[model samples]
Target: MFSATILSVLGSVALVAGHFTITYPEMRGDSFATGASQYIYPCANVNQTAETNRTEWPLTGGSIALDLGHAWTYAFINVGLGTDYPVTNYSLTNDRPLNITGKGDLCMEKLDLPAGLTVTDGQNATIQVVTVGETGTALYNCADIIFKTSATVLSSDDCPSNSNITTATVEEVSTNETSSTNSTADATTTTTTSGAVGTTSSLATAGFVGVAAVVIGWLL
Candidate 1:
């Protein structure tokens, strides 16, 4: 009787423990931006139409420079003609990322400006710069003619600045793995214990019935 009682109590405890320990490991996701800006230009694509295209002034210092490390997910580029554009979408379509922060002299930030667009007289254009993650891309609009004047491209080896790649990481607790393993073991043990208890209870009931039958035969 005592043994049976102990087995029943152990099985119940095991089942309860396994249920509680199953929810151990989890993951969390988050995102943040250090700095961001919103600007728009009404510059139409010079190649798209013969009408006067939009124009912008050059940075007073002759270059647009930006710190790449300041952003993590999405950079927006507005042509003033269209809605904002993500840097990645623009960069992938072309060879290099666009530079809204014009770093090069006559350097059109958007490397893949239509061939028809030209920068003349070193006129400067404004760019709406958006940056994504550490490894994201940008697309700048480079129209050859801004406001009927031809735009020129100034070539420079180290023009627009580049910064280190931004990074995002997700981490779990150090003991997460161990706790997960322990939970699995506990679940397995609980199942085994419950099965064994069921078998023992059935055997005990059968033995009692058989003894009762033998005792009746002796009395007869």
Candidate 2:
């Protein structure tokens, strides 16, 4: 009867596991149909001091997978403190240190960049990822930005560039209209100011970096 009892317990455990999986289905990382996928994670502080490249609990999730298309960044900025720790470099290796230092209060969130495009210098770039909701919404940490680069997107043949690449319409297009650079400077200035404002909360609430929370329904 001992063996029978053990089997019964094992069956119950399996049932529970199944229920959990069904309740919380895994989240799929971003994907690209043409080429490789890319993810960017940016974090900055008021001091603007660049945090070390860390893969610890709060910065990066454990384990990662990628092809040539994967990329990641950790950017910090604080206009008041005059600290702009812009992310200079990153890699998707098994063992690499990602840096993040404590401040008034540690703020954590995932940045969702464009589908396949990533910006190294987010501050200078026009468009970037802003937090839509609470922390831990994204799946991976700073360590491993997952993606698979597609050859088509990477190929120059399909994405030929002319002198007026930005405005010129490709033959693949049927018709088009032209527009001006209207509001370029104003938009840029606004973004810069807004970026600074976003850090106010983080710097004001200086706190220790908490242990990275295990993402529920994470994609491998």
Candidate 3:
């Protein structure tokens, strides 16, 4: 009975450490995929349907949430405003800790546009998260957004470079055993896994890091 209990606990922990997804502002629909395989640009996805389109929200302020499957040590969140498909033109706005313990439901963060910046009432934007580890592997998630604005639509050329936006980078925590962290920033959130030597090894060796990156790229 004791052995069975131990196995069950381990199994539960393993399952919890295998996935992460955006839960707020509604993510692009991709039920068949999980983890990093669930996104392509903002609203584009293999399993996307017309219903998958996210509802338009006010561009000024809102909250973003993440559903963590495993613990991570660091997270970086970026928000981009664009008229293009891939929406590569963006700025980093948030960097913080995510899921430091490896088990949690939803981590929420606030988001706000920079002062003096203007967004048209109908402009399209995207929120992306990049969770990294010392192992050099990362997980990503992107969500589409339509800002409530009355300003005229601007072309890609009209959009300015990310250089104008102020960015903040949080220092990574130092440790010996492998661990993860989770953080929520203004309108964005990032979750990353890091640690000394013990717990993080399981995450690095899970062989899902490379696969997750490929899946994200493939979907794009």
Candidate 4:
């Protein structure tokens, strides 16, 4: 009963707050509304349109930068080829698990695209950023990209947590693997895994259920 009460309070707080921004490639649109709808799946209901800005990325993968807004967040990065991408069409590019404060600017200079997830020159694709914060909510944001063989690739290093590869992570720091939100210039960080911070299905696969289980265990 007490656990239920705590869960209710946390849910309410999370619903009202918690959002992030994609700075580099830029988000499709601002779906950062103050309701559950803003946290919808596959780009948060922020449809792709003629006016939706698209950036050019390399067929060998590219860089992405974001402004995180949570203290502790589980971040995940994904990619879906072509247009009107469905959830299943997206493949996990990177994932990191743990408790870490996520705030400020985080730039992934170069990324190594996952296998079986290749694109041709001038192919349209979308990069999905999923982040789950301390509230166990999955937040979503997406950036449109047009693959180009000419786009510069900075780093193709594999991610520390998973096989997903990325060059380096910066502007965030943590004593352990988890990063701090308010970052410093000199603070070195690991390869920060991207995440979607507000979704039911996303949370289930994102290890957020483990967070809930921990909370429930502590309360009971």
**Most lDDT-accurate candidate:** 4
Per-residue lDDT of candidate 2, residues 105-195 (tens digit): 1112222232333433112211111111123233121121222231011122322222211110001112233467433211001011111
Kindly report which residue stretches of model 4 are placed more than 4 angstroms away from their true locations once superposed. 1-17, 33-37, 86-100, 153-220
What are the Cα lDDT values of the candidates?
A: 0.26, 0.21, 0.48, 0.60
| Residue range with the least summed lDDT across 10 consecutive positions in model 1 | 21-30
Cand. 4 Cα-lDDT: 0.60
**Candidate 3 lDDT tens digits, 47-121:** 334554654656674555555554432445566776444453444342233324443433333456656657777
TM-score of 4: 0.60
| Models, CA RMSD each | 30.7, 20.4, 14.1, 13.5
For the record, the alpha-carbon RMSD of candidate 3 to the native fold, in angstroms, is 14.1
lDDT tens digits, residues 94-178, model 4?
A: 4333344445555666657876676799988888877766666677788898888888744434211122222222222333343
Candidate 1 lDDT tens digits, 102-217: 11112123233333444444442333333322222222223322221333333345332232322111111122235534532111010111101111111233433433343343
lDDT of model 1, residue 169: 16
